[model samples]
Target chain A: MKIKKNIAISQSGFAFDPNSGDSFSLNPIATEIVNLLKDDKDEQFITSHILEKYEIDEFTFQRNFDDFVQMLKHYQFVE
Target chain B: MLPTYNIAITGLNNTDNPGPGVPVIRGLREAKSFKVNIIGLAYENLEPGIYLDGICDKVYQIPYPSAGSTAFIDRIKYIHEKENLDFIIPNFDAELFTFITSQDILSDLGIKTFLPTLEQFEERQKVNLPEYGKKYNVQVPNSKALTSLSEINDLRKEFDYPLLVKGKFYDAYLAYNPEQVINHFNKISAKWGLPVIVQAFAKGTEVNVIALGDGNGNTIGAVPMRKQYITDKGKAWGGITLGDEKLLELTRNIIKQTKWRGGMELEMIKTNTGEYFLIEINPRIPAWVYLANGAGQNLPEAMVNLGLGKEVIPYTSYEIGKMFVRYSQDLIVDLSIFEKLSMNGEL
Candidate 1:
């Protein structure tokens, strides 16, 4: 999955949608996920990378990943 | 030599229902006697002043007052450690009580605030307007507070058709009948809580005055404005300064009687018979305060000087006929500013 190219995401986890004038604050890890998604990383790659960095189980990581990505879709941040 | 100060200001939302933060900042930034570095205490991420350049040197999001005083003070303390705030100016009515109550604690931390005494604050409340007018010997229309929906029916007996139904903090609707009164009562009460105020509609042109008090019964400055045009939201879209002797006398008398401290906006209606009826008394500076600065009396600068414990002289006159027309602009802010403010809580 990929985030919209026009979405401006900052290092501090602040994401602004220029088209909609909507802004959002993401957790640090969620910020990393947005960066990776901007680079066109797949879910498997994202889950694997985060699992190694954070002390989370594969099942838990998968569940949170699915939920967060679903949220990105819900907010129309992902394409 | 001018002393440098790091001051914190709140109520940065310069939306259609604008706050006084940006206008106050503009006035202070233009001060001739002192140099100021403004630290904006913002409640929301989207407050226009947070992103507006040349207004606030930095912005930090603070918790809503409903989140409790502890959280609010904690954030201020943290900002104080980082910014070393000399003083604070709170502009929203919703947060005044919390700030006023915390003045002692802030003083202990070396941050000063000039605000109204709790006694003065309670006297001018919308629910207490009639008593305030009576006590101060000013002319005000009959207004009563409604705590229940059933009271709307009772209001009709004293107030005729087309009465004003208002909330405790904001919003006022002119209701012509029982149906509109109930509608506004439900709408206002649901938003601003109970004790809806129904006022007898006074037929007149609306006029407002922005005045500052020196805490000891002296008016530091006062500027009266007549709204030339008003938007649908009832804000002055265009207004002109007036040289009215009676209005100025009334303002001075009220300030002298109350011994009011800090900034206040007096809303009044001028009847066709040349009588002025008091309406609302906003405790903080109004959004249109920049007009005062344009007219020659820099009230915010005076308030800052007072908060800094410096002696200031009262401004006796201002240039009349100066007009102010409000306009909107869009600012293109970089993502890095937003990032620093959101991620690090500083920008």
Candidate 2:
């Protein structure tokens, strides 16, 4: 999915599109994913990094991480 | 400045509402160009949404009447006296009825409301609905606005299986055959206390077009969309964003023809004949306004700004392939219903 060029990201997890004049506030997990993408983190790297940092069990984290990735794909927010 | 142009939105407390009106209000305030204050008014006690807890300027809870038109009218009058609001925007089905019921009273209080006149409101009934669709050469299912249930048996003889028993502003039940039609019709009629609209079911893809009109029927911005998922409550649960020049033009023409203002969501079905069949015109904000805002055109904000005499820059191009998913709400409902049916061995 192609991210619109005019997309703006705030450190506090607020996303805005200057082209549309629309804004979205991302939850903590969504914020993390988008931020990681902005920093050019690959899927494997994001997953492994999250695994080491969070206290969640591997199965739960992987399921949620995968679901979020699918959602990003669904909304055309990411490739 | 202008005391922030006090604005109040009714129906924020409705159960299972997936509206983005509150979010749009917050976004406008964040811009800080204009002094905009949002007062979320609710008839029922609801768990406070994200906006109610200080994101908006204030949150006012209004107690609605238990029953009848008198109770509804009294609640709006009460809200007006308590808030001294500049303008009021009704956000749900019930509240729309309330606003329309007491529009003149609200106007007398110097509270600006952007909806059609009482005559226009009455004219948008089932009998007149199909005519509007026909004028644009849009297909509409065979429907009759019946005052009595006896008319159903007569109409069913001509029209075949799979009919939709619809309320002018309430419930809609899909009745597969004559037996089901009688059952659904009686139930809905008893509940809504209005003439029921019996329509032939059109099996096709569902699409929606929401437009902002200038009250003269000139549309400022319109978004054409296709439903990706539908909740059990018949709300558009998810949608794939698409736009058509022709669809937008037709929508504008209809609104202009009707002299419609405020917000409207036009429901359509893309039929097998490659035609879009007009289903219903809901004269208020829809559940999918969030998708429209996400793609482009912050409709709620645009309408509020336009109401305030602010110049709203028009945008023609929007991202075409975007989609929106509400998650948890849609997902849970779909799963739970299917699970129950499966457990019953019905699926």
Candidate 3:
């Protein structure tokens, strides 16, 4: 999945969907994932990259990553 | 020098179905008696009021009341210790129960709240409105709370078609038949839980009165308004205060009988025949509370004074024809404000 081009992430982690006129905030981790997604990174690539830096194991991080992606989908922040 | 009062208020969600927090804060900010600090307690990270400028001194995220009173009060206790919050006015129907039950506990921590007693709150519920009307000698449509889908059967025998299917806290739909009744029954129940209340629909103009009682069988302030414009969600988009004696008298009589404490909004139907039927009683301040402030009754301020054990006199007069037209505008907020509130739960 990819973060939509219309979705803008600010320096302090605020996400604004210009089309929906809805704004949201992300934690540091979410900010990183969305940034990677915006750069056309796939979920597998994003997961591996995050796992290299954070102290979480692959399985737990993937589960959380999937859930957060689903939330992004639900809010139409990603395509 | 006048002592500045620090107050916390909930219902900061100023969306389509708005909350009373901003308006209540407006009343406090405009108070003649003292300087004020507005503390916003919000349930969502994006409750709009948290982002608005000149509204709140500090905004903190609190656990939703559905999280239960223990967790709810613990969050308040933490905020109280840090801010020395003197008073709180919880403005959501879904949250009133938690706040009311924790009134004594908060008072022990030196935080004051003026709210309806538990008995008063229960008696004015939608399911009990018929009996409340009978007790107060007012008019009310027949209503019954239904716990199951089977209970929808034979409702027409007691009432008629085109009745109101209502949830305990919010949402209402007009159902023309049993099938439609069941449809709304499932929908509202899923959101607000049961027992879903069914009331005989009354056709008329809806007039609302925002009232404050001194908890002493005295009507402190009452302002009546007629909705000249309503939104698709059934919220009044624009309304004007009315100089209706009958409406004010009904408000006075109800407050006298109930000896209601703190703020309440009386939703009533004034039929074409000039009869008034009490529909709903919101135990806390209404979203239209700023309209009351515009009309000359500073109720939230009075509530703070009363909670502080000070004397307040009843408001005898107000200027009518003041209009409130609600509009939405996007406030350009810094990303750090969102970052602070979403991450730390405070801003």
Best by lDDT: 1
Error of 3 at A41 (Å): 84
lDDT value, residue B171 of candidate 2? 70
Candidate 1, residues B13-90: lDDT per residue as tens digits?
A: 998888899999999999999999999999888899998879999889999899999999999999999999998999
Worst 10 residues of 1 chain B by lDDT: B148-157
**Per-residue lDDT of B272-319 in model 3, one digit per residue for the tens?**
666888889989899998998998999888888888998898899886
Name the DockQ score for candidate 2: 0.03
Considering lDDT, which of the candidate structures 1 and 2 is the better prediction for this target? 1
Off by over 4 Å in 2: A1-79, B1-3, B13-33, B47-57, B63-82, B135-137, B328-347
B2-44, model 2: which lDDT tens digit per residue? 3466788754532354554554455445443456767666444
Q: List the residue pairs that clash in candidate 1.
A: none
Residue B62 C-alpha lDDT in model 2: 53
User: How does residue B64 of candidate 2 score in lDDT?
Assistant: 51
Residue runs of model 3 more than 4 Å from their true location after superposition = A1-79
All candidates' TM-scores? 0.80, 0.69, 0.81
- Best of the two (1, 3) by lDDT: 1
Positional deviation of B77 in candidate 2, in angstroms? 5.2
